[model samples]
Target: MLIRSIRLAGFRNYTEAEIHPSDGVTVFTGNNAQGKTNILEAVYLCCTGRSHRTTHDKELIKNDHDFARVTVEADRADGMHDVEILLSRISRRRIKVAGNTVSKSGEMLGHITGVLFSPEDLRMVKDGPAERRRFVDMELSQLRPAYYYALQRYNRALKQRGALLRELINAPAASDTLDMWDAELAQSGQAIMTMRRDFIAKLSEQAGKTHEFVANGAEKMEVEYVPSVRAEESGEELRTRLEKELHRARQTDIRRQITSVGPHRDDVKILLNGLDARSFGSQGQVRTCALSMKLSELEIMKKESGEAPVLMLDDVMSELDPGRRRLLIRMLSGVQTLVTCTDIEDLAGADAGKIIRVHQATLQEA
Candidate 1:
């Protein structure tokens, strides 16, 4: 898939702007806080119907503005398509694809696939379990609509279960109240767990090869899905196990006023050369692993969707060393990429397909 062009209105610092990017590599050069990242964020929002930077849509709109708009013109294998997003402060955002209104946001996934790498992504390795879980969830959501649906159901059930747990603590209730949500939570959570395990297994295989290449075959990397309940089990087995676990943890959950056992408590463990990356890997190793995981996403998305996802590098080159930068540039072959940098000279000698300058929320071809 290729992003032909994008237009933004009242998004972040930009009042109005349009950019026509090349199909190969487009570079956005600007100083700090000059609306460079905002361009990439807009494209990402158009693709996934969610922002990678923030969950609140209100923050995407400009100050004192009622709404923000982003329109993306993309070319897929089938044909060209348009995706538009409207964000309002007072109401829910609206999403449209090919001029057709979409009531469910989940229906918009995979319309325009993309893989984004930024400085903040390093947290996938060093941060807590929630960050790693989000990494898997976001990528899987884009590739598999069923996964998105199951995830949505699981989250909703988990929330309702937790609320009931809190209520039970305040006023004692019959076990039937908890039993109803347990069955619902386990049914959806089982599907989520099964899909996540399969995805992690495949992701590990891909990321392992990427890590070996990026690390010059000096380190072997592996990704492990750590479920709070069970592993290597069928959906039925998982549901049975979750049912029992939830039953056993009932007293504890009621005391804590939270659902303590489910996919929400799952995690992804990254290991480098047989050691935990989060605990033992150096800064360079951690960054390389993170990059490998992201590049693997590009490959996985292509394999699943039969179209290579657009790659967006949000000023991550500035955070990498010369060797890592070369490794990254080498992997960009045959893929459309969008990169942001502070100075044009910083990307000197790199295969910058098309270079544009962003100044004060305005864009100019260079």
Candidate 2:
């Protein structure tokens, strides 16, 4: 899938902007604070129905403006699709695909898959588990709608269970109330865990292979799924094990006033030669591994959807070495990629003819 064009009104720093993006290597070049990243963020929002930078929808609107609008034209397997998003101050945001309002956000996944790489992503390896979990969750949500539904259900159940736990803590006599919530939580949590395990397994296989190539065959990397509950089985047997573990942790959970074991506490562990990469790997190693994982995710999405996702590189080429940058460009040969940089000179040896310069959110054809 690729974005053909985009129109923005009252968004961030852009008042009224209409951009026709090229499918092959459209470059956004501008100095800092010139709305270079904002354009890419608009495209990212169109793909996921959420912003990569902030959670507040109102912040996306320009100051003193009550609403913001984004219209995206993308080419998918079905045909060219027009996605429209309306952000208002007092009402919930609106999303429409080809003039049809999308009541449920889950229905929007997989239509237009996107991969965003930024300087913030390089810290995903050293950051908290939430960051890594987000990495896995974001891709899985786009690849599998079932996983997205499960995640929504799991999050709701967790909140309800936590509330019950708090209630039980206030009145220990209501201990019986926790049983029902526990059962519900276990059912959904177990399903999420099973799906996550399967997902990480596939992801690790592809990421490891890619990492080896990116490392110049000098380093071997392994991705492992670290679940909070340990069991040596699969399928129903695994579910049974999880149930029993949850039951066993009941007392400890009550003492702590929090649910302690589930996918919420799980992690994706990166290992290089049997050592934890998150703690011991060099900064370069960590960044390379993250990049490898993202590229592998793109390949997986293509295999599942039969179309390459629109690739967005937001000032990330500046962070990579010349060899790695070349490798990334070569890998995206068949896909449409939009890259953001401070200057076209940064692309130095790469194809300069395709560069689209940006000056204060306006594109200048090369």
Candidate 3:
């Protein structure tokens, strides 16, 4: 997939702007807070129907603006396509693909796939498990719409189960009502766990090879999915395990007013040379692990979709040392990449593609 252009209206600091990017490597250079990241954010929103930075749509719209509009034009293996997102302050956001309005936002999942890396991603190793889980979720959602559906259902059931648990605390007589939610949660949770296990397994295999190359075979990376329940089982067996676990944790759930055993509490463990990357790996090791995982994502998406996904690097060059930066650039050789940075000189060998200057919310081809 290649993003040919992106048009923004009333998004962040941009009043109105259109950017044409190169198919190989497009660099956006500007100072801090000059709306460089905003461009990448718009592209991400158009692709995923959500922003990585904020969950609230109101935050994306400009001050005093009623809505924020972002339109992206891209070329995929099939053909060219257009994706548009309109975020309104008073109502829900609207999404359209190829000139047709989509009622369900999930329908837009794989229309324009992309993998984004930002400075914050450098801390993913040391960050909480939620960060790692999000990395998996975003990648899977783009590759498989079925996974997205199961995830949504699982979350809804999880929420209802938690609410039932809290209610049971106040009225023990309502305990019977928990059975319905438990069964629903178990079924959906099983599907989610199954997919997560497969995804993590594939990711680990690819990341190991990438990390070896990135780290010059000095460090080996490993990834594993740690489910809250039934770590070794799946399908009906996993569902049965989840049902039993939910029953076992019912009392604790009621007392704690939370669902205790499910995929929500799951984690992905990253290991570097037999050491926990999160707890023992050095800063350089963590960043390299993160990079390897991201590069692995690109390969996974290509395998699943039969084409590479667009790559977005949001001011990530400044966070990496010279050696790592060179490795990352080498990985972007054939993939279409959109990068944001403060200075072009900071990026070695970045002059091969188009250079667009972003200043005062405006873009000019350099």
TM-score of each: 0.97, 0.94, 0.97
Tell me the TM-score of model 3: 0.97
lDDT of 1 by residue, 201-282 (tens): 9999999999888887888999999999876786788899889899999999899888888988999999998789999989
Q: Please identify which of the two predictions, 2 or 3, would achieve the higher lDDT against the true structure.
A: 3
In candidate 1, position 237 carries an lDDT of 86
Q: Report residue 96 deviation for candidate 1 (angstroms).
A: 0.6
Residue 37's lDDT within candidate 1 is 95
Q: How many backbone clashes does candidate 1 have?
A: 0
lDDT values, one for every candidate: 0.88, 0.80, 0.87
For model 1 the TM-score comes to 0.97
**Order of quality (lDDT):** 1, 3, 2
Model 1 poorest 10 in a row by lDDT: 344-353
Q: In candidate 3, list every pair of residues with a backbone clash.
A: none
